[model samples]
Target: MWTYLIHGEPTPGVARLLEGVGRALEARGFRYSPEAEAPNLVLNAITEENPKPYRRRAQATFVASVLELPRFPEEPIKELYPYLVRALSNVLLAYVPGEGAAFLTLELGHYREKEGEGFYERVAERLMPIACSRLVIDNIFVPDLEPELWEGDELTESMYRAGRKLKEWDLLPAPFPIEEILPPEDLRHVKRLYGIGGLSYGNLSVRKDERRFWMSASGVDKANLKVIGRDILMVKDYDPEKNAILLSVPPHVEPRRVSVDAIEHWMIYREHPGVGAILHVHAWMEGVPATPFNYPCGTYELAQAVAEKVREAPDPTRAVVGLKNHGLTITGRSLDEILERIEGKLVRTVPMS
Candidate 1:
């Protein structure tokens, strides 16, 4: 059994948020105990100003301070907590204006035995959300394309159809219109694609030009990517000298880093210009050809290997390359084309090994 404790004074709205979170956990068999027992989680909602120098700050004013418990019992619980935090934060942000900030802290009893102060602090940092605001932009900015150049084309129509198909197939949580989410001036150079997931994993992209593109901020939920000004980051330039990619974000939007797999996507686009859109899903493609090398996700090695495999494929436009032990990366001339290929290959019923 597990328990929870609340510290600090929270407003009526925040109180309700805590209660709702408790109910969510309780439904999963967690119990509440006033006693400070082992295997319990504590929530500290600090309404007043915190004086601590090390307190984490929110990217925007919507959240004042946020802390995550450094410890958990095990795998499932560890995974579930981040989702809960993300859900709660999303709900809170809806009510909070740009000027308002809500402070929250999560403490775990399991780590109490750890002696070093730095140890717990390090743990808390790791558990915290990737960003205070769901939408993040980098510091760079690029010139926008002329409006006349942004008129709908065959590729745009294909992208729109593909977005709808992804939503229909339940790969995207909701319909995301590309035009609405992106600036009109940026539309001509941009072609977008999205995949759904909870707080931890998802993929989205904006092909800026033939050679460059942008991707979703790391760890953002796909369902929350309804609009563009906030949820995505534009890759301005890649510095091979530093092995770094430069990003351009919207004004007033703080720089949120790109996904770990950004390199992989970059590699694909650089190697295959015919591949206009890419869709990565966390499912197996049993019979599809995969990379011979088993590199870990997000590594440059993996990116290079996946791109090499994709390049070798006979049909670059309709290629499906597996990441050895990981998921599948599908590419096509357009999003609609990718969807058509995926629809044919997807197993409607449970898959047997």
Candidate 2:
């Protein structure tokens, strides 16, 4: 059974709602636990007046904060999204009695309601993917020979230039406002845990060799990637034994984790040798095939689903696939080729399901 934790204070309405949600989850095989033991998910209920965060834990722990908004705003994104992040939880659930509820993750923003009944069951259904998926984020760094690999290689230069192009197109969304949103103590915890100052959207990578590629570092500015180990690192391979992405970084510099989506990229690269490069952006394209479910990033399930979509494409090397409630993952001969093809055809606002 999957273990979970529900924390924070809630109002009468939220408590009753949580009771139903908890029961539904248990019926579907979820066991509640305390903070001391590692749990698969944590549902944090917070009040607007005291929007406190749960203690930091491994990235694998999915922390979703729930809040009750009286007569929830018609446009919650503009009116009340900041407070959700203020809770420092990855997913936010905003609920109202007569009006229904809305859901927001670090990725897409989705609003849902039930005119008839079973709203609680629907909410629990939407959370199933996140509650079940495993995050393959463990990383191993080796001080392997090759300053030339990460320093000034031609492919590496293309990575830098591609980052600039993405910035120019405004494809890279702003990194999360961790410092502005979290308290001083909680802020330190995040940095220490993730080795990242903030979380950002989109990651691009170009093939370095037959088995490896260079990827952007986790939680760094995609627009301005300058450092070797800090901003960009070479993904050597995915280690099944460790269930981690292995990287070859400069021996002198401290290495951070590669993009959380590195496993997804690794799977595609391994499956399609002709596919030379991959570009993932938080933007959409019309008429593109998207995954059926919105699985959490970095999971083997998501990787397998996206890879299957690419495999089904007429040309896996040059295909554009949409990630439902997420964005697009494009494959091309190089980053430049991917950039050229997607120049005029991109939807900035990704549609949520």
Candidate 3:
């Protein structure tokens, strides 16, 4: 069942906005659920007076902060980033009574919902995917990584060199500067809640065999990938029961989690064995068929969507597909080949919707 809840006491303006939103959602089969029921989506209504997270019991529960702002700033990304990060919401809905609506995603995707035909319906359509999507970031660490597999292998070296190449091309942008952005108390809360120092970007992976692959570590400097089971980890498979990616790492080493897009790469690699390498960047190119929506990373919906697009491409092994409001995911026969083909073609700035 589709369940949603509007958290907290809504002010006059917020109540008015949510009334329409609730009706639209009910038309689409979503019922108003109480927090005790663990609703699929929670619209945390925050005003200039009070702004805080609802701190729901389930981390998997998607939270979209409905902020009733007096007026939006000229530069929303700069202004909204802090709110979204501090509140730990997946998306931020900035609303003005009769003005308009704008939102920013965890990926820093900022979009505005223009008032027009099906305006409320349009907002519902965009929020539904996010509400339905569940993050697949749980990792079950195994202490049986073979010493021979840690580093010094040909595939591992290739990954390191490729990571450095990405840095040369200025693709591996730094992780969100959470340390510099948030204050101590709020920072501690966010850190404790999400277990994330900062949001990382861009990942590279190479097929190891029919079943396994090696991928970049999350939240690390891509150019300086040195340690195995730390910088680069082997993705053995996905554990459906655990709802986590299975990683094999050295018993003595503390391993960092694999990139959140591990499942997306895993799906593509499993579907098309010919795809020897995969690269995802916060950059874009011309004429690539893109996914209709930007499903958050680490979700099965995103993996399925990207896989379907890759299957439809002329050549699944060497296809370039765009992730709407995000970036590009390119498949190639090798990392070198992908880098070569994308040379002089990638637009440094990813155009947001």
Tell me how candidate 1 scores on lDDT: 0.46
Per-prediction TM-score: 0.47, 0.93, 0.93
- Tens digits of per-residue lDDT, candidate 2, 284-332, equal 9999999987787778778888999999999999999999888999999
| Model 2, residue 119: C-alpha shift (Å) | 1.1
The root-mean-square deviation over C-alpha atoms between each candidate and the true structure, in angstroms, is 14.5, 2.0, 2.0
* Top-down lDDT ranking: 3, 2, 1
lDDT of 3 by residue, 211-279 (tens): 988898888888877788888988999988888899889887898889989999989988898999999
Model 1 residue 130 CA deviation in Å: 22
Candidate number with greatest lDDT: 3
Best by TM-score: 3
**Residue 114: error of model 3 in Å?**
1.6
In what order do the candidates fall by TM-score, top score first?
3, 2, 1
lDDT of each: 0.46, 0.82, 0.84
User: Model 1, range 1-353, lDDT digits (tens) per residue?
Assistant: 54445544656755654565556556555565645433234555533233111111222212222233223324422433332233222111111321222222111001111323343233223222311112222233443423432332344344445545655666642222334433443333322111212233436454658876646555555545432334555565666655566665544444455665777788788777777777776555657777653343455666777787788889876688876534578877766567667785663221211
Which residue segments of model 1 deviate by more than 4 Å?
A: 1-164, 172-199, 347-353
Query: Which residue runs does candidate 3 get wrong by more than 4 Å?
Result: 48-50, 179-195
